[model samples]
Target: MKLLLFEDKLRENFFPLTLTRFTGDLRCGALKLRQRLEALLTDDEVSFLIDSSIEDLYSERHPDWQINLIKPGDKLFVNCLLKYSPTLFDKIQTLDHEQALVQGNALVAYRSNKDHGSFDPDSVLKQFGISTENVDDALYKHPADLVHDNGRMITYDFDNFFSDKDNSFETEPGATILNPYNVWLGEGVELKPGVVIDASDGPVIIDNDALLMHNSVVIGPAYIGKNSIIKVAAKIYENCSIGPVCKVGGELEACIIQAYTNKQHDGFLGHSYLGEWVNLGADTNNSDLKNTYKNVVMHSYNDRPPFDTNTMFMGCIIGDHTKLGINSTINTGCVVGTGSNLWGRDLISGYIPEFSWGEASLLQPYRIDAFLSTAQLVKQRRQLKLSNKERSLYTSIYHRYQENQ
Candidate 1:
């Protein structure tokens, strides 16, 4: 059977995070949503139905995988935002042709026998003579949902994927592990002296080549991704996912820091989602709780007004390639868009538009040439380059912002 993961109409609700990648690529647990789904459907051939904005980039990154090209056959279509579980997988596997599993108005998965050149959930439902089956499975509606669901997802991913695995590396002398059975270390992981891992509440999975320096405390459920570094005396609280090649320090709680980002300094970041290539300079911190302790309100790309998140804790949603200078202060529920540079001691709050430059109150559009140059340099530090395709995409985004202004 062919398995196709597709994004739906609510993609813009994720905003700046989804601006650079697909929703399925978001880190929910120890693994991405797509990764967990692929693991469960290992027997079937996998493909993706992604937005046209990212089609070329996705195709360029994963040359071997099929994107948007549907063939005539019995196929299983799954929503990328659907939260994965063993029970859900079993239910989806039981789907017969022309049947769709839905949760409320959102279609979760369907099995179809008809040939469709492209994927359109409405078209598929109408043309395939689909019969609907109601399901209670949850779907991610906003970026904060990733933060709120992280701990549960971590436990689920660990129980399903790593529970049977033996430690691939030995813990060094003076490195302490509480509830050792709940901790899984991957190959080449270095746990330096004074490093402590506490997993009594939930599991902790440290991926390959990760380094935990002296005096660091990791309280699970948490994930330290491949080649990532936990700086000295860093406090990584429960429900945090630090993605591959990141350098994290200070304190983090219920946060998802995506790949190649750096927070390698003393700061407190809580209940937030950060995209790839983000940098938080020394002592930069964000406020997760308001002075009145009210539910946080955040701006959405599709929603004109800021909407209530229904949660008292929310720090910020920072887009890819954004940078914050030393001692920067981010107010509760702030949203920073892509390719921006923000600095100063003033409190940064409200919705900052894409490619914005300068202090919080004195924002201006960043020169496209200058932003691209800096972006190229940033990638080159990791031995990667900003390709022509990426450059064109960035240019288009900049022009779109300009056109709106």
Candidate 2:
């Protein structure tokens, strides 16, 4: 049995992270969805059938995989792959148009308005006798759904929610543990006396060498990557992923920060994702909700009328090596491409092109030297030496965006 994880229309719902890879690659609940599925299907041969966009990116890195194309009668197993539930396997095994409910899975399946048949690996999923469905009603699972509450502590699969263990655990000066047991503190990690972890419900994991300074409050279902630091008085919340070697603070929720980004100050960021080597200045915030509860509209590369994202809570997507200035307020569903620098006191609008700079009424192209200098500074703060390969990558990004400018 070959397990094929297809990148369905959920790609639009999961941007920034999905921009680089498939949905199964997304990490959450102490494990990635793909990895979890692999564990369950130990006897099967598992692989991915991702979007053409991802195929394009991975092709250059792994030439042999270029043959990994969607073909007719491919016999693929189709899944949204955005969120993982224990019952997902059964659901995929028996999904159809009329009798859609599979066992105990609560996820709703609806009709997909987009024509995914052209792009979807339909034939591949058919091999399992589990053909794909174009359902727009596929209700996304929230992080809270995975949690199970135990009176003493919440035990979730391999991870623990809030437990009495955190209560008995000692904290250094200035470290505050709000909702105990909700967070996992890895070895060599230090929590400055005032660091507050509010794992009132969900679990928070502070990986090895992570430090939370005084006055930092981290809510449940949060992950602070290895060797990262939470600066003083940072207010972080649930469903946020702070990647390794980063420094973060401010208000963040449902945001995934790829390795080595910094948002170290006071700001409100919700429903967003950031790529590697990005930085957010003090008071830089993103809007997750709109005046009306209507679906969020996002600006794409070719589409002029902001694309309908279906979800009302969509936020911004910042690509790799991007930087933003202090007091910057981003509009909902904005997409900031790789290597760009944005700043201003005013609220910024429109899609920011890759490697372009600023969006305060007038947008400008960022100088490579200036961008590199900032990148160097960020690396230094994290006490990391910039590798030649990374510098070369940045150089390539600089040139690639220069063409667009």
Of the candidates shown, which would achieve the greatest TM-score relative to the real structure? 1
lDDT for position 86 in model 1: 70
238, model 1: CA deviation in Å? Answer: 0.4
Instruction: Score candidate 1 by TM-score against the native.
Output: 0.96
How well is each residue in 227-318 modelled by candidate 2, as lDDT tens digits?
A: 99988888887767676888898777777766777888889988876777888888888887888988777764433355676677867878
* Candidate 2 residue spans exceeding 4 A from truth: 8-17, 27-33, 40-45, 49-80, 93-169, 292-295, 309-314, 366-405
Q: What is the TM-score of candidate 2?
A: 0.70
TM-score of each predicted structure versus truth: 0.96, 0.70
| lDDT scores of the candidates, listed in order | 0.89, 0.61
Model 1, 1-405: lDDT tens digits are 898999987688888888889888999989898998888875778889999998888888889988998888989999989886678878889999888888887888999878787788756655536798788845788888889999999999899888865654577899999988899998889999999999999999999999999999999999999999999999999999999999999999999988999999999999999999999999999999999999999987754677688899999999999999999999999999989999986789988888999999998898989999999999999999998888887887788764465
